[model samples]
Target: MSDMEDCCDLQLCLDEIPSTFNLEKAVCNHGFFMMAPNSWIPSTKTLRRPLRLADFSASVVVSISQPPGPSSTVLLLRVHREQVIRMLRLSERDERNVKEFHKVHPEAKDRGFGRVFRSPSLFEDVVKSILLCNCQLSSKRKKRRQEKDGANPVPAEMEGEEVDLGNFPSPKELANLDADYLQSKCKLGYRTNYILKLAMEIEEGKLKIDGYEGVQDAASCRILIKGISGVGSFARASVLMCLGFYDEVPWDSETIKFLKHVHAREGCTKKTIKSDLKEIYDKYAPFQCLAYWFELLEFYERRFGKLSELSHTMYHKVSSSTQMREFNHNHVL
Candidate 1:
């Protein structure tokens, strides 16, 4: 039997979440939550995803939900407790960040959205950043596609049912995966080698992605993350944010659109976003990303309604909703 098959599963109901941690707000706070393997059940207000074991030998699907009532929240995890805690932002470090972030953006404090969710491990976050880098190969960059994927759009039959999503692979798993398989199966395009190299480096211990978790400085983390192949300034910022350093907000074409449409800021493009980051988000200081995300969450909810109520199938609309909605209104779709 395969290692995954050999691994015995455990029913873990960890109520270790912070009192202020809102499951829906935290899980649906970021674009990563909508990606593959991270399934957010709107009806149940639960997050279901596969978490790789600490040793990377196997993975287990974890259904994390904040059940209503007197009992504490239960997460169906069978892996390391630390992994679950970190993924759910239950660690002391996460608590400190949330506390500080709330102080920076008190508006978000009341909204219960300071904890931006991330992958279970640094390797997962790194690979996820790579996958997000060139999403043109995926559904992210589609221009003239279905606009009915977000905000109360899922097919009626699919509601209240669990949709099986793929697992986010670890360094060891991806390192062993064939390049051709990655290209054909994942449609990675030019990013295949970058991912392969990163996976191999992590598996071989040549690249210490996890060691930087202890480093609190975003600059140092950005430099180290940028050193990884395929990681640019934007990806570096994103990885840093995942590492609990929210000082930097990654900017791209989407960011330009968000600024132009949401904030009515003209002359805002990818070329000028980095220089404009401070002027745009400095008020939030170390919680700049959270501040930026707060506006995004506000804009999203205003445009399409509360994201928490958005169906999982419709979650695809989120990444491009701002741009797509404006485009659809102008042009016939």
Candidate 2:
């Protein structure tokens, strides 16, 4: 019998297998699962972002050990332990410092911010950043196209109609794709060239995501990722928080609006925001200021709907709801 079959038999003998052993179902319900020699371990965290979770799933499978080997038992356990640690976010995070950050951003209380989670592999994070470029939150056409192209749009689905875009593409898969094909699949407008360029660079080994692991220093990682094409300050900072272990203060439009409301400034510029993030994080060694920052933004969004009105005055016109729906229908179908 194959190692996987042996594992299954052992699980049955030990009565450790759960009644529900469906990988897809378990993953959808719990956000992630760790494949062990004799069991499938489920995570407690419900993935809020389905697409991101899908990416994590794909990447994890690749990194995990394969079945059908004598040593597979050891490999499976090691990989399972690692995956569990990642899913639970039970790595070297400083909880005390995170709580202090929440205290300062009182508005973000109980929002579940400051939970430091591992991001997918570097290649996946970079691709995700590229996908997000020049895209508005309400752009349905673009999102629908992504859905139709086999990308998981949501992390998990509540209803029959929802579609989950799986994780970002691997370097080998992405490198093989043409620019036009990527544009059509991702609905990447002017950013098509950037994605292609990034893929090529990664494939050629000029850029390496694995090298950035364990740095913990946000500034250093930010500078490293920013060197890639299409990765600007905002994208770099956000990706660093998600993938690299950097606790970054994301200075997106939403965050800027909240900062303006609280501080009464025109808004914090990218340079000023980056400086402030560095300064704030300096106090908490190895703790990220980003958790509090995300909490503050989520708090603002919950209290007051979209901060669209704030951006409307300062930025160009965004897509209307009707237009967004129409776009979603066409591409998603």
Candidate 3:
């Protein structure tokens, strides 16, 4: 990160650009955008985060920005951490999914959106998914970010900035960590063993998560991902969604909150939401998760404000208290 001239830049050609791509909606549409090692910089209209280079030698902090000129074909990325450039480089399937998803969801089509941002690496998505399980999301997100910052502080890419940013620990890094260390340092509680085992499995060649990305069948993908040590139903569905198979929506407290406010489902639990979502949401087919997500997002905006403008650390902001307040104020009359 030292050499000032070591900065790398990439120009994405028109062929790679989506016809209706909007960077803000794609990156900020998901809570993952608010998690550690990922950030949406509103001030600069860029997404900044640490990316592990293809060589796997190191993680480099990269800034992805769209050009301000008339050209719509290219995105400019300036990464001072390394000479290699990569950030959300999409595939043909990804583009096609965006197009197909936009067609069904009118609000998304109107906004030129449908893709939710995820880590460029499948490993990062997997590990983050584990941490998110059995915990409060927004708080756990901040906790994981803080813990990671303290655990692995990388040198600041900026020359004069006396602050160093944290990188999410890579599989190799986590594989070498002790369970006690992980639990205590990360405050991971019971999730410590799941993560430790998962990292070790990947490191030892017992499991290959990246291969799961090519899986097109939802049920098969779920089985394979859940085969991992720590990945259960929620985490498996989450990883599946990350892999672009969104036939299922991962249900949690937020799912209940969404069902309550948006669908007026009084007693929908995680167990029941899937059936409910199927009847209400499955017509969208493979994009059921996307459809479900936008409904939740639109409701959030209607209640709170634009998610892109809100503090990224506070996702959804849908604690029971928040919902109760909304209910009382709106339903009191």
Q: Pick the candidate with the highest lDDT.
A: 1
Candidate 3 local Cα displacement, residue 237, angstroms: 1.2
Per residue, candidate 2 scores C-alpha lDDT tens digits across 98-146 of: 4555565443334444544333355544544554444565556545533
The residue-by-residue lDDT of candidate 1 on 93-170, one tens digit each, is 888888888887888888887888888778777766765664532354453344444334553323535444446666
Error of 2 at 177 (Å): 0.7
Better by TM-score, candidate 3 or 1: 1
Q: Give the Å error, residue 314, model 3.
A: 4.9
lDDT per model vs. reference: 0.69, 0.43, 0.65
Q: What is the lDDT of candidate 1?
A: 0.69
TM-score of 2: 0.54
Steric clashes per prediction: 1, 10, 0
**lDDT of candidate 3?**
0.65
Model 2 has how many clashing residue pairs? 10
True-structure RMSD for candidate 2:
11.2
Please, what are the lDDT tens digits per residue for candidate 3 over residues 1-333?
344434466565545654756566667676666555565666556777666555567656677777665346766675643221212426677778878887777787786557767776687778777766766445665465456445653324322232334566677878898887555555666677877788899999999887886787778887788688878777887788888887888777777877877788888986787788888888888798888878777776787777666544344353222221221222211
Measured with C-alpha atoms, the lDDT of residue 206 in candidate 3 is 93
Against the true structure, what is each candidate's TM-score?
Answer: 0.81, 0.54, 0.80
